[model samples]
Target: VLDPNSFTGQEFMMWTVAVYGDGWLNFWKELKPAIKTVAPGWSEGWVKFTTNEAPLMVGYATSDLYFDEKSSDKSFIPSEGGYIYIEGASIVAKKEIKDGAKLFIDYILEEKFQRLMAEKNYMLPVTDIKLGDEYNRVPTSTKLVKVKTKDLEKIEEYKKELIKLLKK
Candidate 1:
């Protein structure tokens, strides 16, 4: 339901204000006590988590799948809420090899290719690919929500606000 014309900068700001409320600036202030240390990036955060320096870290739900066979640890979407990420394959416009790109996109949607992606990448297939028993152990949630494309337009602003809040 993303109407390109309706998603102006003013609308995006209003949406953010409505969803976050007046105390949005205090978000990081409230969570600061629980945060041990903020890593520079995801790799550093993962290292900290693996070394037991941090018991918990923010990461994708599929993260635990990497250690599923070797570790007892698991990742789950909390009951409060979770994000649904949809990965898509698209043929690039104005590409010289447009036909080749289309073929690649078509191949990605095929069952065999989708299955391979699910097994190797530890990702849920966008297609109707059936996963094996191994994937059953991975936890999934029904309460996941997807962000609208219009909302995504404000992501940079949100990130800037988050950085400013964290700095305080």
Candidate 2:
């Protein structure tokens, strides 16, 4: 069995279509195995990393997007392919605003605001921009060295069954 303390990191792909996809059991099943791979001796209480860092901002992880920098060596890229879907709140309004309010919303959709959000908020912007050094310094960046287009597409499906074989 692997040592619990010896574990470096894990990216548990937690989710459930029911309850709007926020099911702990669903998350546990996916995460438990990855954690076990890192530390076979680990149990539920042995791990602790919740979603309180930026509670307002949902931080969903992609297999291609690792979270813990220490996990680089213990990374798990699934072979069957599956992406961790992150659900975040939107700033939508019941009714569209007029004038400056509308302009401000429109501006947010622009590249300028997107880059600023990425730089200041530490959230990846949907826009296409080379993440500058400032943004790259974050621990998140260390885990997310972008993969190629083809590889990126295949990330969610990756089963990384090799990890299981390694346990033997």
Candidate 3:
């Protein structure tokens, strides 16, 4: 997911800011050396971490309920304002979306579906919905990063800069 050349690269789009918070690029230079491995994807990282191959890895704070493992692994919310990565829905203005797709999007946004997604998929619902009691055990941070919309336009530039920084 960190591959800068890939169309779906998410390091610039989400991971950097969400995982590290503000000024993440600055801290990355110092932290990269200590990082033993950068898993190709989330599943690989989580597996390595869970199996004790990796001490720490990027993962969902709600993973404890999902895996039900006892360990020293702690979900950390970066004090500098860690951004919660929440995927959103949007229709491309250039593409013509049929009624079926529109209905599907609307359906997913509903509280009932949202609650189901939270329960089964382990994702945060867009709207407030009562989740499982185990959700209460997950760590939450009041200090959340609010990404600037203007910075979104600079993603490609940030990608190049991040790739360069990673190479160093």
Which ten residues in a row are the worst by lDDT in model 1?
A: 1-10
RMSD of each: 7.3, 12.8, 3.8
The prediction achieving the highest lDDT against the true structure is: 3
All candidates: TM-score = 0.72, 0.34, 0.75
Residue 112 C-alpha lDDT in model 1: 91
- Winning model by TM-score: 3
TM-score of 2: 0.34
RMSD of 3: 3.8
Candidate 3 clash pair list: none
- Rank the models by TM-score, top first: 3, 1, 2
**Tens digits of per-residue lDDT for model 2, 1-168:** 232122211222211122123342444355445442333332322332222221111123221233444443232323433333232434567676567766776777789888886666556777687776544433332222322455435433432432443344
Model 1, residue 150: what's the lDDT? 64
How far residue 23's Cα lies from its native spot in candidate 3, in Å, is 6.0
Candidate 3 per-residue lDDT, tens place, 29-136, comes to 776787666566677767777787877765666766666646556677666555566677776675667887789889998998998888888887888788888787
- Candidate 3 achieves a global lDDT of 0.67
Quote the lDDT for 79 in model 2: 41
